[model samples]
Target: MIKAAESVGIRAEWVTCQNAGQLMKCDALFIHGTSSINHHTYRMARWAERERLAVMGDPQSIIRCTNKVYLAEILERAKIDTPATIVVPRGNAD
Candidate 1:
C-alpha cells in the first residue's frame, strides 16, 4: 500500500506502535490491521480523527462494526439473511 501510494506521488509511511507518534505529521491515516474499540488501531483512528486527519476506519465505524449484537440487529432490520443467531445476555447464559 505504501508503494502504491508513493507511486502516485502521495507520501505515505507505515505507522506502528513503535512510531505511532509520527502520525501527527501525516495528512491522512489508513489502518491496515484489525481494528476494534479496545485495540491500539482504534485508538490511533480516534486520535487521527480528533486531530482532523483524514482516516479510513473512522472511530464511529469501528465502534459499530466491532459490536456483534449491533451488527446482528442492523442485518436483521435490513432483511439480510444470516445463520441462526442467539444473543445471550452476560451472566444469563444458562
Candidate 2:
C-alpha cells in the first residue's frame, strides 16, 4: 500500500510495530487495514495520535474504517455514490 502511494510520488516508509520503540524523533505513522486492529496496534496508533503524528485513517473513530462495522455504515450511508451497498441484505435485512 505504501508502495502505491510512493508510486504516485508520496514519500512512504515501512516499519514494524516491534521496531517502533519511540515516536519522539519521528513525524508520522501509517497504519493500514489489518486482519484485526488488535490491542498492540491500537495502543501504538493512539500513542501516535497523542504525540500528534499524522495518521492516515484514525482508529479512534469507531475503529470502523479499520473496523469493518463502520465501513458498512459508511458505505450504506453513501449508497448513492456507492450503489452496490443499496442492495438489501439477506435474511430480514432492511
Candidate 3:
C-alpha cells in the first residue's frame, strides 16, 4: 500500500501507534491492520479524534470493524448479507 501510494506521488510513511508524535505530523492516518480491543492503537485513534485529524478510518469505525459482535450489529442494521453467526460463552462451547 505504501509503495502504491508513493508511486502515485503520495508520500507515505510507516509508523506505529507508539509513534503518535510522528503520526500527528503526517497529513492523514491509515491503520493498515486491526488490533485487539486493548491495543494502544485505539488510544492513538482517540487522540486523532480529539485533534480532529483526518484519519483514514474513524476510531469508532475501526473498533466496530475489529470486533465481530459490533460488526454483526452494524451489518444487521444495514440489512447487509452475512453468513449465519452465533456467539457462545467464552469458556463453554456447548
TM-score versus the correct structure, for each prediction:
0.85, 0.56, 0.74
What order do candidates take by TM-score, descending? 1, 3, 2
In Å, residue 63's CA in model 1 sits off its true spot by 1.0
How well does candidate 3 score on lDDT at residue 38?
76
Structure candidate 1, residue pairs in collision: none
Highest lDDT: give the candidate number: 1
Off by over 4 Å in 1: none
How high is the CA lDDT of each candidate model? 0.92, 0.65, 0.77
Clashing pairs in 2: 63-67, 64-67
- Tell me the tens digit of each residue's lDDT in model 2 across 1-89: 77897899876666567777755556887765452466566677777888898865455652765545567677776773553544354
Candidate 3 lDDT over residue span 1-94, tens digit each? 8999999999988878556688667777777776555777777777777887777666787677888987887798899999997777699997
| Candidate closest to the true structure, highest TM-score | 1
Q: Residue 2, candidate 3: how far off, in angstroms?
A: 1.4
**lDDT score, candidate 1:** 0.92
RMSD (Cα, Å) for all candidates, in order, is 1.6, 4.9, 2.5
